[model samples]
Target chain A: MTASIIEDRGEGSPRNGEADGFPTATPLPVRTSEKGEEENPSSILLGTSAEDHHIARMAALALGLSVLEAAIPSPLPGVKPGLANIVTLIVLARYGWRTAAWVTLLRVLAGSLLMGSFLTPGFFLSLSGALCSLAVLAASQHLPSRWFGPVTHSIFGAFAHIAGQLLLVYFWLIPHTGLAYLVPIFAAAALLFGTVNGLVAAHYLDKNPINHKIQRHREMRPDCL
Target chain B: MLSIAHIKPGDWLTLLLGALLTAFLGVTLWQGGAADKAIIRSGGKIFSVVPLSRNQLISVPGPLGISQIAIHNLQARIASDPSPRQYCVRQGWLKQAGEVAVCLPNQVSVELSGKQKNYDSLNY
Candidate 1:
């Protein structure tokens, strides 16, 4: 259905082929009728749509936040507020899971590179945590949205992130049973930080509710689907 | 669009799970039983084992110097050490299984373990 709409729009708009850059390579019938306005054409030549640009911009923002977090001195090695995840929650809420996944992966990759911890144990731990949290966020989508807001998603993601890191630490790094004693402390930290992150995300979402309508429009875009 | 309203059942479920996990871990740590003996290790090797039931002070030599470990009344503590920061001495006592006091500069570590020991490794 969406393909047909894009096709119809393609036939009507002379600017579609112009935006695509490689107009002569693939010629199609062009109708003279006009209706739809021409969307941003820069993405067509770049092979990346406006939505991709948006994702990249958000990913950069998340990376900046991650670097800022790393700059802060922490007494405990593993304990962090994980504020970078706020961008993930916002992206998930506004753009859905796929965009959120892209932003998160990019943040983890680029953030680690900027911090000079790429391919190190720290990178692996961050990757594992991000992956687990993304999985949780994806799974949380099935729940009724009326009840599960950014706060709930944030909490679940935070706990899963910690649990994933702990599992890796136990099996690969330490392999000692004594690590169990610290579980309580870690869990408590997870709970506290999760709630804090959730509240921040929720507050941001509340103030910027306009993104929901814009995201809905983007979802209807054929290239996005 | 996602609702920004009161907490839902799913939120409660997560909250409940996190609370339950925290509570379980807290209880286990709080109820950590007394250890029968304390194991002293130096340079990653077992230096000595002192029974906590008997009151005694033993000195173990390591890279930095000797660290005196005192065991008495089902508790063990670092009595004295030559390390710059008497961090191990400040650790006070290890009455529960899974507790550990380490004088890292001296390469001496004291850990409590029993039949019902809770931990297999002390990370810090």
Candidate 2:
């Protein structure tokens, strides 16, 4: 994981590397001669790197939550607490939007496969909802972090997700005039669940911040030098 | 640990937005009360159209049994039903143009329709 993060820093623009407080421009030779020479054989054979493993771990966590949620019978067909969204929020806060997007897409794919809903209407709805939430999260980044946190982002994502699914249903699945009246109910549910999930994500982020972990790892690495 | 103690402007913004959305929906629901009639359906077919202006009681045959509906003072409600859940009755009253009360087990539903429809369909 450290190696992959270093590689990311090394490949990023100088300004980005500087922002991360890493001297990427001059570290390539040292990195390759030392740790890069001892690449793990399993990672090489599988064509998976530390970064892929990191994404996989997050996706797996989200998939587990999705499966768990499915086990509980819900009164409404489309309404679920959406606890899996917590992983996406954490990834977005720690790793940035691109990584969060990858994690979210992976979760949707893997989760559908696990639930045996792949290629079904359920899968399409999940895909659309995930994409919509990610788009909303991306847009919400424009808001000042000081004023916004995981909870706010979660609310936005939830509303966007429901809107996306409803639009699809209206246009393709059921074009009947009766479906629009349920929007208020669904919107209320989204607000409630979104706030809950956001608070959970915020708690997790507060306790286990990725930047602090990274900084600690960096500080401890010189002990082995 | 990174601690977040206070609600920020963004948090307030989201809360305000959510409140605004709720208010908008509430207003729409309130405005929907102008509906003139209630359209009742049984087994996916139009069972009856009762004028909201009249005070009357109507019983429609449904899957489970007869679902009784009452219309009075420009509003309609499910008075009684044989359905176990009685969800339709729990919906209370429908005065809005797009309001609906459904008894899924009995396959009975009542929807309001007015001169001007506020929404084409609701998505959930």
Best by DockQ: 1
Per-residue lDDT of candidate 2, residues A153-212 (tens digit): 999999999988888777878886566566787788888888888888788766654555
Candidate 1 lDDT by residue in tens digits, A1-225: 111111122233334434332222245444333322255333233233344456677888888888889888876788899988888887777667877888899999998889899999999999999999899888986678887777789888988899899899888888876677677888888887887777777777676554444545554543332
Where does the lowest 10-residue lDDT sum fall in candidate 1 chain A?
Answer: A1-10
What are the per-model numbers of colliding residue pairs?
3, 12
The list of candidate 2 runs beyond 4 A from truth reads A1-46, A212-225, B1-6, B29-33, B36-113, B116-124
